[model samples]
Target: MNRKVTIIASNGNLFDAYKVFNIAAAAGASDDEVAIFFTFDGLNLIHKDLHQHLPVPAGKKHDLERFKKANVPSIPEMLQMIQEMNVKLIACQMSMNVMNVKKEDLVDGVDVGGAATFLDFAENADVSLTF
Candidate 1:
């Protein structure tokens, strides 16, 4: 059966971005309704420029190389894949205001909204995760 999956991403690191995308992609591929709520640092994952060059946390440089060598999809590639799968990508409006992020700075097709919006989507989620 199809399920509802909600993910909360509040981290800025590459690892967290990978985790969030991996989970969302998996759920979406399984025909789940996936929504990712990006708040705080997590918003970096959806930032058009930042997402293309997400920073690897110190000491994890080797892991990044490994992922690349293993042919792990790039952040932009994963975003495209998920978008094609129709996953919901929401950028937290409050976080944007506090962080000085503008809608134009985000990738195309992302919805800009507040907590109530995310909560409303997550309300019936069969799986909810934070990364």
Candidate 2:
């Protein structure tokens, strides 16, 4: 059987969220099944309109320019890369309701679910991480 990993993202911080996806993608590439559950402010990661807006790292000088110049992946690009690698991205339906975000507003391929749904994935995961 394949390994299973679940990542729960609750904060909206860009760096942390980026790390979660990066790790998950690496695990998936190793033949593990990875699922990322976005809740609370983390749901912003899936919002179609907001996905492309990369947050600037605080106290970092010229970091954005360096990243751009090096062709580092943007948040949206990272998300797309995860999807292309078959990593599942799930957005919390309850959070979306509270945020007044519609299904159409989420990025393509996002699976919408509630707490129980995420818990199911967690139950079967060999490794679980909460961000």
Candidate 3:
């Protein structure tokens, strides 16, 4: 059976965005259908400039260093990998309007959509998660 996974990324934080893309990439690599929706603050993750520079919390400096030391891919790198893995990335149209984000502001290959579009995909999802 085809296992479908849906993830909603609602935060703009670096780690959260990384986690969402990482999970989607992993799932796609495993041959599962994977889709991610970036909503609210998470929309920033796909912004051309913003996606390149996600801030690390002051308290998490050591964690960032450790991740770097461990060779974890950067957020932008992970995003590229997700695309390479064929994971679907969606940007919420409603949130985009509220945030004044235009289609040109987002990375290439992201589908612009609304709740109904997400729901259509979610209807067949065997697993759904939000970060």
Candidate 4:
């Protein structure tokens, strides 16, 4: 039987974003049903303009080169891959209001909703994670 995976993405840093996307992608590729809830600064991951330009954590600018050398996929590329793999991306409604982000600010195929929406998907999740 396929497992249900739910993820909460609450960090805005590039490193965290990379980890979340990578894990989500892997789970989806394994035929698990995956859902990512973007809250607080995590909403940046689904934003069209911001997702590609996320910053490394403070004083970690040097890691950019390391990521490149490791052949890490770009944020946009991962987003595309996850979408193609049928991963569900949800943006927090309250976070969007606080950040002044509109539905149009997100990439295509992202669902915009509140905590209840995510909880509905997460309630019976076989695996739950936070980033």
Candidate 5:
């Protein structure tokens, strides 16, 4: 059976990262092969340092207690878990250039490509989604 591929045209939103990685983790845990394609500011999610400690933003009175109570993994933890499960993380080449990100700036093992590379993979995927 063809495995699902989730392609996210991501912007650098901390909350959005949590949501997409949450889905990817659930799918990966289920033995469903998956990929997360990062573009736009989504590149921030793969940065070696930034992704680990994203602030929840201001004036929201964000509930850290709730987050702790729920045991939801942090972004870095989620990324690590998904990678351990063999979920593919692709960083867009163009986006990287636009954002002034060097490949070395990203965490290890992230694949780099344009749409042609990703779309080819998407063609055979059992499912596809974007964030």
Candidate 6:
């Protein structure tokens, strides 16, 4: 019963976060326990206010507009899916402090802790990835 732990380290785009969530769900379905740790800019991924603020890919004519029209999953929706699948979402305590984020403002069911907590989970994970 090896586990998979993934830490989202970047806040590039919504698509990236979506991809990570999809991967985690697939792994969990296969019986590998999944955990997702949000750190650095990645912290925005779990914030209700900032989740939808990610850029929608620029240039390439109408790409951003078309993508928006396709009804992409909102960050909150993705987070809900992650929760429903029993994925562990951890908020980096250091990042939260630096960003002045209050625990009360975080998405529901998120566990708050520092790097050590994430490291402990990673150590036990049979597969670990930093995104």
Question: What does the lDDT read for residue 43 in candidate 2?
Answer: 82
Between candidates 2 and 3, the one scoring higher on TM-score is 3
TM-score of each: 0.97, 0.88, 0.95, 0.97, 0.90, 0.81
How accurate locally, in lDDT, is each candidate?
0.94, 0.83, 0.89, 0.94, 0.83, 0.74
**1-131: candidate 3 lDDT, tens digit per residue:** 45899999998988888789878877888888888999999998888889888877668877877888999888888889888878888999999999999999999999999999999999989999999
Q: Per-residue lDDT of 1-131 in model 5, one digit per residue for the tens?
A: 43686768486767778878888888898888798888987888888988876657565446766777899777888899999999999999999888899999999999999988788778888778777
Listed per model in order, the count of residue pairs whose N, CA or C atoms clash below 3 Å is 0, 0, 0, 0, 0, 0
With a 3 Å backbone cut-off (N, CA, C), the pairs that clash in candidate 6 are none
Q: Encode model 1's per-residue lDDT on 30-129: one tens digit a residue.
A: 9999999999999999998999888899977889779989999998999899999999999999999999999999999999999999999989889999
Q: lDDT score, residue 20, model 5? A: 80
Q: Can you tell me which runs of candidate 5 are displaced by over 4 Å? A: none
Candidate 5 TM-score, true structure as reference: 0.90
- Root mean square deviation (Cα) for candidate 3: 1.1
Clashes of 3: 0
- Predictions: Cα RMSD each: 0.8, 1.9, 1.1, 0.8, 1.7, 2.6
lDDT of 6 by residue, 1-131 (tens): 64675655556466667667767767767777788888877777777677767655456446556656988666677678778878888898988898898878777888998888878878867777777
Q: Which ranges of candidate 2 are over 4 A from the true structure?
A: 69-71
Q: For model 3, what is the C-alpha lDDT against the true structure?
A: 0.89
